[model samples]
Target: MNEAAGDGSSFSSKVIGIVFIILLLDLLGFTLILPLLPSILDHYAQAGDVTYQSLQSVVDWFRKAVGIPMEKKYNSVLFGGLIGSLFSLLQFLSSPVTGALSDRHGRRPLLILTTVGLAASYAVWAVSRSFIMFLLFRVIGGICKGNVSLCTAIVADLPCPKARNRGMAMIGVAFSLGFTVGPLMGAYFAVSSKTTGNVFYETPALLALTFSVIDIFVIWMMLPETLPKVIKGSSSHGGDSMDLLSPVSLFHFTAVTRTKEPPSKERMQKLQVLGLVYFCYLFLFSGLEFTLSFLTHQRFKFTSMQQGKMFFFVGVIMALIQGGYARRIKPGQHIRAVYMAIMMLIPAFILIGLSWNIAMLYIGLALYSFAAAIVVPCLSTLVADHGSANQKGTVMGILRSLGALARAFGPVVSSSVYWIAGAQTCFLITSASFVIPLFLLSKAQRSKEE
Candidate 1:
């Protein structure tokens, strides 16, 4: 019996490892296109290009409605912003369904199916020529990668509550590395293509496709059901019965399960506060992230390669802090650390908004990366600590959805602000954007104390 138990533990650990690696690959495949977005949009923004007319048509609509000045920058920001936001929008719409289905069916099948779908999207991306087809690829990829929360749900399902934090940290490590490596390789492939008469322009997509195929194999061979059906869909709240196909269900977690016993007044308030905090924090940061490229390119004349390197450095810092220093944070102590990190971002955004030199930009980005690293895992573990075990998966899924929803809107708003108000104004606004969350956090703290 002892030997059998040990073997079972080993198997579980192996499965967890693959999930971590696959999660890493999923993030990597997505971020691989980050450094290339500006160039790609510019590529199709010309008069004779296939995507130009359709893209410019949208830009013209925005101009008429908002009275924003019209220029090539309008087309560029719209294209990139739309592509980025669409991906997140789909994730917002699909996350809980992915989570709920995994809860009802089993993690193994959902995980495998999502992986296969992602691989298929990459295949389409590799062959894409026109802007419309590439946009189609983005939509397909968004639908495929909406499994972001299922990974968290699995971590929450861990038998040991403490283990969930460690697990989320490990996932964070992978997440950090994915951002670190993806753009670096993307920029390299893009720069290399220039020397080869521009044939390698499609190289980034091909490489992302290759990674997706490999991820599919690893997931197929190794992963087991993280969430078993027996414990999958039981509602602590009454039987709310979520239909993933319903449009209304997309916005509400209640679509997943009804309440048998509604949560306490305190839990409801905490979740509400946390949801607001999560949405606001991600919204500001993602806006900062989405517009950073424009700011750098305009202010410092950065190439795609330089931009990729900057992102790489940020990822390095993030991985180190999340994987190493974050472990030292004890369980109930996460709030203090979260408060500090949230404050750090204010000055960081200011530096990015005002940076006109390489040194200043890198310094600001390093600070930004550190705050992000701390907030992600700490927030996940902190929120996971609340709520009943039976309902934890749904809670985490909802949290991920909130973050995704914020990201969906972040880029569009930030880009428009940047276009209208200038980079400095845009960054300054984002810097002050934390005020809402800070206020919410203080109220939550007082409520907890009371």
Candidate 2:
């Protein structure tokens, strides 16, 4: 809320639009690989790659030890979650470094560096022959996943604090559209080769690589450095910034609501509270998202195509909200929007956990999807409004990096719980997790009043 407003320091609409494209393309590359990687493993296994040799050995041992069959599709789904967790883990480790680097240097150079690296990683993926080679590409891709955080930081830097959510909504629209189309495109390429007995496995990666190349060009040409001259040299700590390496520093919510700065107490507390609440919410939501396919398969026997359709539907709803409704909502109303969305989570979880029919399942999905769509821009607006000018990149990165950390661990833990307990129990526990955020949100309100 302490953001300074002026036209002279504002970013151009063109730069924001380009940032949107960059985020879209980044998600596009990710989604392209996500749905298909498990199936791709079958190819790698058949090829007798040493990595596949090791992985198949583990899979065989697990099946034998547990006396349970891990069918091709089931194995694909489980391995897919593990792979996603790995990517998120890498993103968590790298995001703060990227954000801090952006602060010390500038956003544009970091954006360009990551974008180009991502494109090259995709290129490696396209040409990959062995399972180790594929993992290598994924490792590189994970390291470059800091673009979105940097782009969010870039959006936060624009002149008007209140309008930051609108910019984030535009980025969200790009994300929705990418989510809608990327997997479909990857599927299309994948299906063309799926019937060939593992001969056409590279098609999807090749296409994703192509899109990444375009992203790199766009970043180099149109994206401007949004870091203002005044803020460029603000971070004076030189070699091996100690705070950057400190785990305590990483977990301090939003940089110590404990800071003794007289003028910053309220602002820091708002961010600290919101950041913690949002991180918990994201962790639960991600767990639900990852485990849903298992739930549907058990309850409805849904195929891969059917699951893809479900995600496509969620993406459409998000795109509509972010592009239309979200942009129209006034700044003062963002908190109300966040609260309304949070309330929807209760019924969303209950309906999902208790659903016995397709109608109930989709209805639950719709409610949850709508809630998530609205929350993203609202949270973005809140963080940007409160972030210190010199520390925006670091703050934004830490906020999102924690979410990345949750996403990394959420899937594995959720899936393990689902197996040990059951879908209903898992959903109910996730629903109970909402109590933390609700309590935090109430505290935020009281703090503001005080």
Candidate 3:
């Protein structure tokens, strides 16, 4: 029995290790493309393709209605924002369903399937010759984007919240590493392609595909089913009752609340409040984040390589904070930590918005990276504490879904504001808007205390 216990511990360690490595690789692929998006859009636009012209016309009409200047750069940024929103929208639609399905079936199989789908998306991207084909690639990638939430659920399946918090921190580290290395590689390829006068983006696409394929194989070979069979059987209605198409049920997490053995009403309310807080936070954050590339390009004339270097800086700072500071945060102390992180962002964005030089920008980015490192991972840890063992997947899924929903609309709205009102105004307004989520989070905490 002692030997068996040791074996179980070993297996859990191995599983967590694999999860970390896989996420690191997957994020590397995901971030690799982010820095290149604006360039890709410009490529198609310059080609005078039908798809680009059609989209540009709609964007131009909107700009005219808003009385903004008719600059082509604005069109590309707005266009990129739309594409980013589309990806998030698909993720919003699919994440919960994927989570619910994983709950009903198991994590291993779902991981394999979704990873395969992601690989196929990258495959399409590798051969894409037109805006339409690239759009299809985003569609496919977004639909298969449930792997992150599933990994979170797996962490939640751990024996205790403390262990889960550490796991969440590990995941954050994976994100940090991925973001750090991916953009640099992307920038390198972009520079190389530009020098060669052929910028089709096949190399990065192929690299992403390779990572996805390796992830699929790793999950298939190594990841044990973290969800117990007893828990699996009970999740039969995991997310079945929640209307996938409806925002009402998805935000409220009816999938978890409506379960055969639901959490208490108070718990449900707390979860719902938490979900809203996450949505509001990401809604504000993602908008600014998605536009950062355009902001640097327009303000500082940052080339692809410069943009890559900028992200590398952010990623490194985020990783260090997650590893050195965030992981050490006590389990029940996450709410306090989250408060501190949220407070940090208010000034971070202000500095960023007001920056007249790279020094001020980096200062803001440092604060931004620190806050980013702490908040989401801490929130994930806190949320995991609320769910029962069986409801882990549904709970994590709904949270991710809410975040996805925020991401879907955040970029479009923020980008529109960006083009019309200018980056400084957009950043200032959004920075102040962070208060909304902070207030909501405080309310949730008070309710939890009550």
Candidate 4:
């Protein structure tokens, strides 16, 4: 394929390194804002004296705009997630279009655009004085940030099949590392800000915004244009015909069209099975976000710092499993391991629901994180293996869209469950949700053997 161009070792290394850095920066900006949100809302709600009146007015305005109940200050977290889900929805909507754009307009502009959008989002969040303003900024950020799609595209462009899994695993590693480090940074900011008693200064949103600016600068200076230009007057014949700028016409170009084996009935069945598995995986994954945040607040009465630290530990476990062990396993075995890991999540969720203190929560989080790390890389590898090279971008785009859809509903479901049955019941229901997928995966395995 394409004469296997470039020094394989160096090329592999560079791809992984660049992607890892990109994911790290992207996730770091994300995680830094999460833990501090509930605290920020509570802080503003409980302010004293003259400042309290202003803060109260801001909170009241937010509640009215978002339709959140006035009794619950922590509803801020739910609203924040709702806002984030809107962003996820935007990502879901744009993924296919963006993937197609990358195919047409090339990857460089999209990448640059995503970075700039993220930076702008952070800037909006940092300076936001009201909840409505915050939500508006988050939506803008969501519309702009397409890091997941872009990173996947980068992997598609640079790596071969055999090395692709490893390349993706490195992306997972970057996510885990960012997960680990970002919250710690956020926690530090929150604690220092708490100690100083400066309302505006301690905001995690501002910290996230600063990192985004740095990321923008890094990308602008260091990242190269990965899309090559079509040679003038060079076609499959003697004529020059490719139009790079026309999004619609670019599909007709030879670069976008390549022959591949059609999907057999059997392959279609397998894909259906995998798609089901992914749907369930994302549902459970989204539920965990709610469970963790709710449980942290309920069981240990954790401060923002404590919550951030717990996530940092979860990130560590994920980094270890994804980075250290993913490549050691074969593809089939990796999938099987991931299935077992999903099963393991039952106990982890149960433990989290039952956790009486921070220590127990940490233990549960670690187990959950390790299981998650295994599942993500394995599922991604499976999708890549099942897809043809020509349709890889499209298939991945669909998968990401499904994930975004799941994320959109996940928080809403989790919040509803928490409200109805309480934290323990919410975890129990989520635990039960894992079982359906495990059974489906088993059935798929049996069908495959046949």
Q: For candidate 1, write residues 2-61 as lDDT tens digits.
A: 111222545546655766888888888888878777777766664357566766787788
RMSD of 4: 6.4
- Give stretches of model 1 more than 4 Å off: 1-12, 64-66, 197-200, 233-262, 387-390
lDDT of 3 by residue, 1-450 (tens): 111122255555666788898888788889888788888888898899898899888888877887778877777778988999999999988888888777778877888888888999999998898999999999999999888899988877766545566678899999899989999898888677667766548788888998898888888776778887766757654347545547898777777766677878898888888888889989999988999999998889988889899999999999899889999997567778888898999999989888899999999999999988988888888777776878888788888888999999999999988888888998999999988988988888788543
Best by lDDT: 3
Clashes of 3: 0
Per-residue lDDT over 1-450 for candidate 4, one digit per residue giving the tens place of the 0 to 100 score: 121244376676666676777778888888886677566556554653354355456757866886656555245445545655787777666665565565445555777787788877777776766666666676887677677766776676554666677777887788788889998888788777667766543366777777677777766665554433432112122121222222222222222232244355566566656666876787777777755765576557877778788778888888888767766777568658878889889888888888887677777787799787877767767765554444445445556666676777777677656654567888888988898889878877877532
TM-score of 4: 0.82
> Root-mean-square deviation of each candidate, in angstroms?
3.2, 4.0, 2.3, 6.4
**Predictions in order: lDDT:** 0.74, 0.73, 0.84, 0.66
Taking the tens digit of each residue's C-alpha lDDT, what string does model 2 give over 117-179? 888888888788787888888789888888888989988888765446657888778888887
Deviation of model 1 at 348, angstroms? 0.6
**lDDT at position 221, candidate 1:** 73
| Clash pairs, model 2 backbone | none
Using Cα atoms with residue i matched to residue i, what is each candidate's TM-score against the true structure?
0.91, 0.87, 0.96, 0.82
Candidate 2 residues lying further than 4 Å off, grouped into runs, are 1-11, 41-78, 195-201, 238-242, 245-247, 253-263, 294-303, 353-356
- The clash count for each model shown is 8, 0, 0, 0
In model 1, how large is the Cα lDDT of residue 19? 67
Cα lDDT, model 4, residue 70? 56
Better of 2 and 3 by TM-score: 3
